[model samples]
Target: MSFVAPWFLVALLLVPAAAAVYVWWERRRTRGAEPWATAPLMPSVTRGGSRRHRHVAPAIYLLAAAVLIVALARPQHDVTKKIEQATVMLVTDRSGSMRSADLKPNRMEAVKAAASSFLDQVPAQIRVGALAFNQKTKLLASPTTDRARVKNALNTLTGAGSTATGDALAAALAIVRPQGAAGVQTPAAVVLLSDGANVRGRDPIALARRAGRLKVPVYTIALGTDEGTLTSKRANGTTKTERVPPDREAMRQIADASGGTTSDAPTTEALQAVYKRLGSAVAEQPGKDQLTSLPVGIALVLLVVGAGVSLRLTGRIV
Candidate 1:
């Protein structure tokens, strides 16, 4: 907790001062007792109950005063708050290799499920966009707060052509970047999921460097196992098996160049976990919350209780 006006806490000193005054008055009253003619015959006049009980009302009043003083200082505390506004571009690989059945039903279906779950977990205030890439890149959905639209786009994804990772990143950046002459930058991020190495389109490393210059992080997720394979048809009326494993090193390099993180997900569950972590990173921010009202409310309740106890116990309210 922090205080906006810390000097107001100095008022707390009055509580101890009042306590001292009450003690002194009580002592004086005891010392100044009037003399009695038949002192031995007179019954003792001291209060018979516990002496500590007499000070309850005064103690409550002092505590209320201290609380109110602290409230006047305008205390604050650090709190975890969701991001008010942000843009997230989801770039997914729709290359033929994504059809591999290594991850459950298929890589593409697994990716879609994990991505949908990620979208659901994202805060409503964040705007999300979708882009699918193969031999070419296409924007499936523009940035918007309507998550249903993004999910709809994800459902329409299909695997075909070759991996165009660079073009996909560029398209994602174009969608997330602000459009104006002033070129004002907003808080934005990109999440790329791929199951194969780049085989077509522009240079992914160059695109990552450009994204870094624009201060946009491009988190990369490599989704596949080393033993993954894809069956392809040859021109001579025959089929051949091709190894299509996730290029983790390339993805890591791209992420590093763009000032982002990289992860490898061999299964759908691991992919979803990675997405959940990324959602937390992009959807929430650190903030401070003012707690002055809390203390003030507590002080008000204490004041009422103190007055009620004083009136019930003693004949007058403190």
Candidate 2:
């Protein structure tokens, strides 16, 4: 917490000073009464019950005074608030390797389900975009709050061609944080999910560095397991199988270069969980909120309660 007018806090010293004065007056009055009332008659002369109870209302009033003094200082505090105009780009690999059946139905179908779950978890105000990449990159949807369009793009995606991770990241960065454009765009992020290595695209590490320069983080998810494999027909009237393990080291490099996080989603459930966590992580930013009204409200409540207690105990409110 910080205060706009910190000098106003000096007034807080008066509360304790007032308490000291009240204590001195009570002691002096008790000494004067002792000259007239004997020890046996002192109990009758003074109010019944514990004498400490008589200080309750005054203590509450002093507390109220301190709170009001703090309120006058106009305190402010940092708060985590949702960035309504924030945008997130979902860059997914639609390369042939995604057809590997290691995770449930297949890696592609699992990614779609997890992406849908991500969309559902994100705030309504946050716009989401989609991109599908293979040997070539294609923009399925630009960042928009309309979930249906993004989901439609996801549903229409089919795995083919070679993995082009770098090209996809470049495309997403262009949409969210274009080069040499204007003052400042709203907070933007890219979520990249891919299986297998980057084989036929621009250098992914270089692209991730560019993303970092633009202050746009790229959260990378390496999907699929080591045991994953894909079987396809060769050009020569024969069938061949190849290992399609996710390149976790490359994914980590991309994330580290872009100042983002790297996640390994070996299973469909893990992928969905990672997406859900990112949904909450990207939607908010730290902001400052004034807390003046809070202290003021507390002071008012304290004053009212103190006055009621004072009247009930002493037949007068001070």
Candidate 3:
């Protein structure tokens, strides 16, 4: 919650001041009546209500005053709203390094699970696209509301060639970018997952800069631990084991350039968590909602109830 007119909040002191004044008046009246009547007879003279019941109406009025002061401050809070016609591109790396067994059965398999979770978390109104990249980028499915098609495309991905992070991001931008600027109001975003540095195709940082220019944010996830390794067989017989750690710095740079977030998922659980957050982020945006009327309504109701109680108990409304 936030306040637009914070200065008005100082007026809240008036509530406590009013309470003190009411307390002083009640004590002074009681003392002044002591000369005319004894304490026992004072209750009979007051008649309609007990001392406790008499305070109820004043207490309610004080509450109303406090709430009304809050209303004057102009409070606001964050509210989530679904983005209509929003397009999100899910780009996953199918590079040989993704075949590493650091994350359970394999990195690629875990990525598939996380991507499926992302699809499930995203709202049905959002259009999602699937893209897999290795030595080149492949658009398995264009942006569509059909989750089955995108999931099927994700399932087809397998660890293969070199990483082409830049090219994959570029391909996504081409699909989500507005045609002739007429559809510019439609929101578009890209989520790129990779386990290694760019080894082929275009420069990813450059493409991320282009995405920034197009007002499309590109979220980058660097998956895989420092100890991650990939084993490949040589033509002659023996296998060559090579360390293929995720390029976290590169991912961070890409996200920063595109005005998006960067996440390092060294394990499958962390990757899934990252995707879950991204799913909500891409589907809905936070909007500021003014809550001034809420307190104002509450205050009005409190005042009306307070007035009615005072009139019924004391034959006068304060």
Q: Rate the local accuracy (lDDT) of all candidates.
A: 0.86, 0.90, 0.91
lDDT of 2 by residue, 31-91 (tens): 8888889988875676543568778888999999999999999999989988878889999
Best by lDDT: 3
Q: Write the per-residue lDDT of candidate 3 for residues 13-94, one digit (tens) a residue.
A: 9999999999999988878878889877998665368888999999999999999889999999989977877999999999
Q: Which lDDT tens digits does candidate 1 get at residues 94-177?
A: 999998989988899999999988998888889999999998999899999999999999999878889889989988877777
Q: Clash pairs of candidate 2?
A: none
Residue runs of model 3 more than 4 Å from their true location after superposition: 1-80, 178-183, 286-318
Q: Which stretches of candidate 2 lie above 4 Å from their native place? A: 1-79, 179-181, 286-318
Q: What is the full ranking by TM-score, best candidate first? A: 2, 3, 1
lDDT of 1: 0.86
Quote model 2's TM-score.
0.67
Per-candidate TM-score against the hidden true structure: 0.64, 0.67, 0.67
Q: After superposition, how far is residue 254 of candidate 1 from its true place, in Å?
A: 1.1
lDDT for position 272 in model 2: 93
Residue clash pairs of candidate 3: none
